[model samples]
Target: MSIVDKVRELCGTKKITIAELERSLGLGAGTVSRWDTRIPGIDKVQKVADYFQVSTDYLLGRTETPYYALTEKDEPSIQADLERLIEDLDGLKYSKETEEFSEETKELLIASLEQAVRIAKMEAKRKYTPKKYRGES
Candidate 1:
């Protein structure tokens, strides 16, 4: 089943409105509405998945078991917890160097870092210099 189908199933006897989910989760209505057709972001998917105590894979129709299910009304605390978990995981992944990175992946990483360095230098210049005296773009 798709994520929308799983979310509807979890709603059960009561109807779960998209607005309710949006408001409770502090997300835009369009974001939830898009889930009706497109693949959701990890954060949005995690919001629904966290509410149902299920893994994002399950919510995305990639798995079957509901990992940690909760109610439709649990968009707040559940989303917060899920976001925290995601952030923690991201931090760990970014900090750790992989034993194996494909040539293409390594090249892409290098390119991205080069752009990031340029952006950082620009930002540092902006912070230290007076606006009127700053170098032209």
Candidate 2:
């Protein structure tokens, strides 16, 4: 879906109209609607993403997952986690010699671990943050 479409969909879920969202964000009239034909500025995109509590990647349709909130600084930590997990798996001893994971399997495992970490972080934020501080009621 287009950025405009995604924004509209999110507005729908929040039970607000596009115009209302524009007003809430202090944007001019029809700014978001124009995104269908024109590429919006990064600042505008970020404002919309922040208002909806979603990542710009989700708003831009780069990712289907709306809440993958990992930032650039978190990338190194995720990589380290993946490496440590892989090493732990490799270190495990079995009755028979353990076979090494295929490259594809390793990739899948890393992706799964990354996603799991993202979910855990999101959950922690939701659980620990005060309701007044969150976007939701």
Candidate 3:
């Protein structure tokens, strides 16, 4: 499918609105709408790719395995799973600490934090489902 098609499908499935994408990507509403209409410019392309955690090629449907592959229904499921995992891990046990430390230790901590965020996002994506609410009646 074309990038526009893929984007539309992904958004529609996720219940993600154009306005939400625009706000998240810090673009004008028309920006994403235009993307929905047609292939966007490189900069706009990059913004969406970054937000979705996919490569520009993948966003363009140039890759088979989309790096960021989650439908609208997928987002909430992923989020719920991630939340559960975080809860199980006792994520609230500690806040990010800013302690005086050697530059190496600080860098390591930063790397760890980044990895944590990536893991959380991936976990959410893996558990995401485009259909069925978590606790809807």
Best model number under TM-score: 2
By TM-score, is 1 or 3 better? 3
Tens-digit lDDT string for candidate 2 (10-79): 9999999999999999999999999989989999988998887776787888777555345576678767
lDDT of 1 at 20: 73
Per-residue lDDT of candidate 1, residues 73-131 (tens digit): 44464455545544554434432465455667656765665555445544554355443
Q: Can you tell me which runs of candidate 1 are displaced by over 4 Å?
A: 13-15, 68-137
lDDT string for model 3 (28-73, tens) is: 7677556656657899877776566556676676676554344475
Give residue 32's error in model 1 in angstroms.
2.2
Model 2 gets an lDDT of 0.77
Off by over 4 Å in 3: 36-39, 68-137
lDDT of each: 0.57, 0.77, 0.61
